[model samples]
Target: MATPTRPGNYREQAKTYDLTRGASPTIVRAVAEHLGEPRGRTLLDIAGGTGNYAQVFATRGFRVTVVDAQLAMLEHSARKLGGGHAVAGAAAHLPFSDGSFDCATLVHAVHLLQDPSPALREAHRVLREGPLVAVDPTRENAPLFVHEYFGLHPPDDARPSAEDIALLLRRAGFATVEHHPFVYTDTADGSLHALHTNALHLAGPAYLRNTSFWYGLDEEARRAGLDALARDLRSGRLEERVRAHYLEAAVRGHETVFAAWP
Candidate 1:
């Protein structure tokens, strides 16, 4: 039998995935604000591909671990971390002991899991009385229909909503949690450019999945779809302004002066 696809398989398209979702550094700052000062804190960033947000805490003097199942992505993140530990591990089974760190974070990678409950539970067990942050691209904020039209639903189908996410974290032992919406804006022109870049990156898989139906006219149809999408984007019919919701919850058990804890 074929090897089942795991979270790390996503590394095959890590570059595009990061570009598509990595903008908006504000979200990371907000998470930091919640986690508070990093003095004497240790952080475990689960499935933290390329360590985009992990660096935030690491720079603040916290010992950071960037864990992912993908060697390629872990390698990429290691270059940025510069001697910081980058471990090749699965989120569902983090290679750590209980209360191993001051805090933990899972950014933009939750929805990709086949089972998130185990990972959340692991995060809870590994934290030393601090928050376990989980974040993802909200459905409302994603380029839903456009991506679907292009047969890019494999990843989309993996994403979960805010409500479901909160429930999962609570079950995993997070005492208290809060959900917030993060808004992303893009003008029609800008949105179109972003979409084109995305489509091009997804073209290989999308062509095989979608163009199969238009085999006799695959090339022509593909070009036409691109043209039509561009026209729609330029004509303001594509709904360029995108808004995505993110969740930031502080697990209740730990109490610090002010909601922000070190």
Candidate 2:
């Protein structure tokens, strides 16, 4: 089974991170709504790379402070949102006092941690009776093309489901927990042509360098996967396989938000 590259491995990808990953307005609204009206309250964005979500949250009236382990990523966040707001710290060891934040958010960051319990506990400790919203990818809803082409499969032991995360939240001292599952279908073109284009893009050198799946693969495996994808595309077999995968409902991707309160 394939696992995501460690958080420390993200340093080189920080320069082009914003190009492929940006804050979605829809996700921002969902997280903000769960966090409640900002009311000028302080928000701590844990593992917030480049301050993408932090920037949006600040505009929504939350005094945002972004904490990331990577100095390279923190540098970008500092540049985007001015200096003091970006702090160099680990999620499990946040440099803040107890009950320092009105709310907290972990956006697409749980997978990076080897163990998320400590981080959840830290979040609960720093929050003052407010929500700690976490957005995590649902492995069950991962697109099949990801596994078929990249050979990346997140084992259940490594990637927790929504229910598993809720249990962790409870163990971390959260009293109430709510799950909100959402599918990212707005960009799904639902056609063979769209699948073809997406496959080519995923197999491209730029994606190989930046994406976690490609980063996790060894050099020989990466080369083999790329070569196989190229041959399939040339032989027109890629479209056929993708169409069948879509029919089996393997092309859809979704995520879940776990809102926990202390």
Clashes found in each candidate (C-alpha, N, C closer than 3 A): 0, 0
Worst 10 residues of 1 by lDDT: 245-254
Top TM-score model: 2
The RMSD of every model to the true structure, in order and in angstroms, is 8.2, 4.7
Q: What is the alpha-carbon lDDT of model 2 when measured against the actual structure?
A: 0.74
Compose the digit string of candidate 1's lDDT tens values, residues 162-248: 667777888888887876654322211112212332333223333222211223234655576556666655665544321110111
Regions of model 1 farther than 4 Å from truth:
1-3, 14-23, 138-143, 151-159, 185-225, 234-236, 239-262
| Candidate 1 lDDT for residue 91 | 88
Off by over 4 Å in 2: 1-8, 151-158, 185-200, 231-253
Return model 2's CA RMSD, one decimal: 4.7
Which pairs of residues have clashing backbones in candidate 1? none
Candidate 2 has its poorest 10 consecutive residues by lDDT at 186-195
C-alpha lDDT values of all predictions: 0.57, 0.74
